[model samples]
Target chain A: MPITITKSTGQKELLNIEKVKHACRRAGASAQLCEVVGQEVKQQAKDGMTTKEIYEIVQGIISKEHPPVAARLNLKDAIIKLGPLGYDFEKYIARVLAAYGYNTELPPILQGACTTHEVDVLAVKDGRAAMIECKLRHEIGIFISIKDTMSTWARFLDLVDGSAIGKCPHIEECWIVTNSRFSHDSIQYGHCKNMVMLSWNHPKERPLPAWIDDKGLYPITLLPQLEHNTEKSLIDGGFVLLHDLATADPSLVAQKSNIPEETARDCVKKAQLILQA
Target chain B: MPITITKSTGQKELLNIEKVKHACRRAGASAQLCEVVGQEVKQQAKDGMTTKEIYEIVQGIISKEHPPVAARLNLKDAIIKLGPLGYDFEKYIARVLAAYGYNTELPPILQGACTTHEVDVLAVKDGRAAMIECKLRHEIGIFISIKDTMSTWARFLDLVDGSAIGKCPHIEECWIVTNSRFSHDSIQYGHCKNMVMLSWNHPKERPLPAWIDDKGLYPITLLPQLEHNTEKSLIDGGFVLLHDLATADPSLVAQKSNIPEETARDCVKKAQLILQA
Candidate 1:
């Protein structure tokens, strides 16, 4: 009998081991490791078990050999942990955009045609510019709705109108970036208006997770055994990425985060291991 | 010495007795009664007291003679009590529109050019129709932001496009109705777009509270001494307006609400007193 599993969205379906392997592979696990994790998950998953439980099983199998891939698998949860507020996520997106050769800034109150707008991230590359709206949801199963996309478009229109009248910078593109999935209507509206929407699994060819995984841009929050306070301290100290922490001197990290040198050294070692892997 | 009182937004100002008198007069208190209440508020007022404390003093003075006016004074809070969700507030707005001779309905699902919209209330009058978005905030000091107004306009545009393509209803006006105040940028945007924004104090004249006071259209939630469960039952049974409950058959109210007939009769009598006053 096929074992049934409940998805995060409360829908039930039969557990497919191929999907398990595919997810592991997407998280940067080797094909051999993916097969091993898939077999382990198939053995353990019972009827009515949640997909979250199956995910933990896969993470455990991958973690024993490849801790970095396991960390990458937990990327969605780590990103959610970045916020009860979205300011950090906005900074993270700016950094990600910078990594892709875009010079980005969190503009201070851009004046639109009708009113002022506090834009989240503005990225410029090769004489072209984009206004990015970051929609961060701390909870799972919450979609970025059409209302959000529509408002973003409206703000873009105001900016365009302002630009025509010499009030604000001209934005060539409007982008909505979210850690969660977009609603179907949001996706349709975005496509219809030619707005660039980057979410967890949108655009099929290169979604947000794919971009992070391709660049190995894992957040420091994904480090295993990280205390909440220490993680907050690292993020506050501008060490949002594991690469940042790994490249920094341990003593400086300790001084900046106000933590013991030994703890900082251990954190650095863990970050180095993850990056090296 | 001038007494200082804190406004709801945490700004402190000198207590203006004229403002208190104005508020009382706005609530339909007799000019003589307004004078009495204003004097009592001034006598009891202290430095660093909240405007809410002063409001209670006015309500106490008025309740003894005009219970209905006192209830009307609580209209803002009463509307807030209508929601943790916005559905009841939408229904209340629809009823209010109906009372003003607009044929209204909560459309099931409206198809726009790009996507489907769950419009809050659609009101039609004199061969012109409007799509009203009801924004109900449960907390005080939360202003309806520009993003909300812009999105409503975007949705309205989609509906207009849909009508041109024969996909949905043609709306002549777009209105945003809220029990809270609108942000300054929201007001600017609404005015620029010619959108009708009816909030607690927008338009300066004939605001939401003024409209409610003009026709004595108090919600049933304003009924004094109403038990929480009893209020829920009455609201669920379609007694949203005080006038509706006042004119309802007492035995029918009791049977529908599953309350004692005497309790229902007492509720009716209280409603009658408020409506008559």
Candidate 2:
């Protein structure tokens, strides 16, 4: 059935529902799943809206579908998008790399009982595969014991052994990424072949220019560079934290740079949530 | 009458009740208040505590004793020794002045809620007064807004008008310190007779040297001298927050520095509390 749809501006669109339904059945999802999503899309889709935003709306609806094969598919996509630990470490790694000018394709991280085990990030510059292992700085540099450091080393060893991702040929160079600095002994333990460690602590060699002003770019490497005198003068003159930018202090930053005052007030709501949690 | 007491390790000493009573009276506190603190400090305070720590213990007990008067005395002392906002702003200005080989006691900053006027700093060295106004930044080669740039000027105007910190009798040159490049407007605004605007944003003009390996030299002017390319870089590399170092992290750092953690923490805490307020 071909249907006419109207947008908020009074523009009209026509979509073929029968064609999509048949396509959905052929693709193995229930026809009802396609109908609900298709119906909503026809009703709400605006003229010239970006495909990515439309996809996001569909994704949101998928997460809310009843009897939920759509929800299962949403979970499947989420598992692929953000593997485990409530966030996709692989995606974050891809972001950090992208922010660094690397071409990368990343797979969902392999999940374990406690945390994600093997993160699958692929750096494809000029179509050559560069496999990376992703790690997050769950804790910001508060070291309780040496045991935690040793465990991270062991996880890398397991990735090297090819246990995290299922057996596959066409493997490339393995990169281990972390948000925190490696404890002194952990770096010593990472002396294996085909292993490169990138961390906020002891930033190893990376290919990013100092001109790019983002703080997280070459996170750890920049620290040692900053220990360099020239860089210090440049940064010290005009640095402001994102949080500080959002403050009510009129003299600290431009008014627009300050997020809406309500957003900061929302932090109080988050604090309340923590209290409730 | 003297009372005999045994230390935790069984060392014996005679305590003078009169001295204890007098110390409590000097602290404007009672014996019961002292006992309550003694119990908590036993759990919180460790061995080889300093006289300042003991004073803080007494002060904490007597905190309710004329809070405003206690606050005023501290404020007056900050004006005299530390300048406005403390953290050795006077020392930073002294270095800046001496760089051009000038001698100067800057005017005292008026400290109280009852006054709208505040001065950036009062520098006292070699028998002359250099009233200095300073600002800090984390970005390189950026312009600040006119509205945001007025606090330092407002404070300076307050001092010049003789409404802030009484009359500035030991008058010398007015110095403006900035961590970033001053806008064209800021330079014009700073162009009053006897005013010198110094931007730390320029490398040669940077009063601080690059790569100071000396831990003893870290100060306000010298801070931008260290080789940190970004704020997070310095923070993550264990650049301790003055407040965190003094109050919460002192016990942790005491393991490294020979100073008693409590006293170190308190000093850092007192300085930060004043800055934030």
Candidate 3:
């Protein structure tokens, strides 16, 4: 049975099982499991199912077999929901790095030989610092391209040169972190340069979703009940991590974010579920 | 005779004396003088004159009476010829300030409260510094809009805020110098904010052309003999001012720029003529 799925952008297209298998492989699912899930998803497919609905069904089948892989797949869509707000996304990245025992400097605008460059997040530990460039995408189809990778490398090089000239502090490592997938050439170039790149799924060495899941530092945007004006309020109040929201008093969310007490309680409940999920 | 004049981009337009008169008026030419020059230029027009040729005829007639006013008019087109090289233009601006007894720093990237910004030329004299933003345009019809003005203001504000916090050097004034004309709103906003804006014409007090002539520091691009590859080579060799080329030996120009000695000598001769003109 063939099925037409409606996308978030209101575009409808026939769902292809090959695409499903490809995404599953990219997410590191076993081929045998992918075949089984593909068959089950096709069986459950209907004419007017939304893409989100289809993804939920796929997640259900996949999670029964592999929960971590299921979480990673869902995490892609979850990160996309975190912006339009770029600074909020940067804070979220900081939270994730903090969980890994790295002290992050929020924005270090280092003077360089050629120019002054603003590094997104500077992670320091044990007298070593990594200058990081974070590229956050709110849209699903956007990819971090080779141009971005090259520019980041150039900025890193300039800062390193600046350090040689006593303009800025010395950086020991360079990293580029993004919520979206990487372009093929960018991944190849980054691998060749030994530059650490953490995207949605590339370099199987350390994909971002796995890093987040292992650290259990999910963004507050992932909470189901916290949205729109409340989300903006929370972000304005510098509340970014789900763990922080989950542990805080429900009345604090209501008072600070000006949401109803019932809604605040529901947000806390959702955040707790996400933490335990 | 109705003449067809080709623009730099190779598009042709009929030579209209009315347009000539309008240009003359905009350049602050007297009505009676504009009428006389308009008639004389029309009489001198041939079948296929270039726009540059027409401007020269207008300039020659105007210069006979008012040399500085003619230099101001000719300076606009001369500055336009300086780029596609932005860094060279910044150097040219620095040289202009140097001529006016201001100690200038090239490409100083100052850290601000919000971000790091690279100021094109920082002019300091007697314990006061002015951060300058230079906008160089290669194309003729393009005007510097209010958006550029606002962003420059924002950067200036951030740097001033940084100075308050002791992040960088204290900037006493903010100035924007552009080869092109400023938009009406940009001029109005600059006036309201007490910001110094030197464009082709708008800021009646010390406009860019007037300021350039006051310093007598003409860019080497203004030399008619220097164009194309030779212009690029001269700029690359750090020979931005015509006065420098006029003083430089032809052998040195030939060796440094790899142009023929004869061409180098011709460039120097032309530079001398421009200096005297």
Instruction: Please name the candidate that would achieve the greatest DockQ relative to the true structure.
Output: 1
Which wins on lDDT, candidate 1 or candidate 3? Answer: 1
Instruction: Score chain B of each candidate by TM-score.
Output: 0.95, 0.36, 0.76
DockQ of 1: 0.69
Q: What would the per-residue lDDT of candidate 1 be over residues A51-169, giving only the tens digit for each residue?
A: 99999899888889898778778888989878878988998898888889999999999988888898999999998999999999976678898889999999998999889999999
Fnat of each candidate: 0.69, 0.00, 0.00
DockQ of each: 0.69, 0.01, 0.03
Interface RMSD of each: 0.7, 25.2, 13.7
Interface RMSD of 3: 13.7
Ranking by TM-score: 1, 3, 2
Instruction: Estimate, for each residue in A145-263, the C-alpha lDDT of model 2 and write its tens digit.
Output: 22333334333333334544553324445555654455554454343233466664344444111111233221111211122232222123221121222233433322233334443
Worst 10 residues of 1 chain A by lDDT: A138-147
Choose 2 or 3, whichever is better by TM-score: 3
Per-model chain A TM? 0.94, 0.35, 0.77
TM-score of each: 0.89, 0.23, 0.47
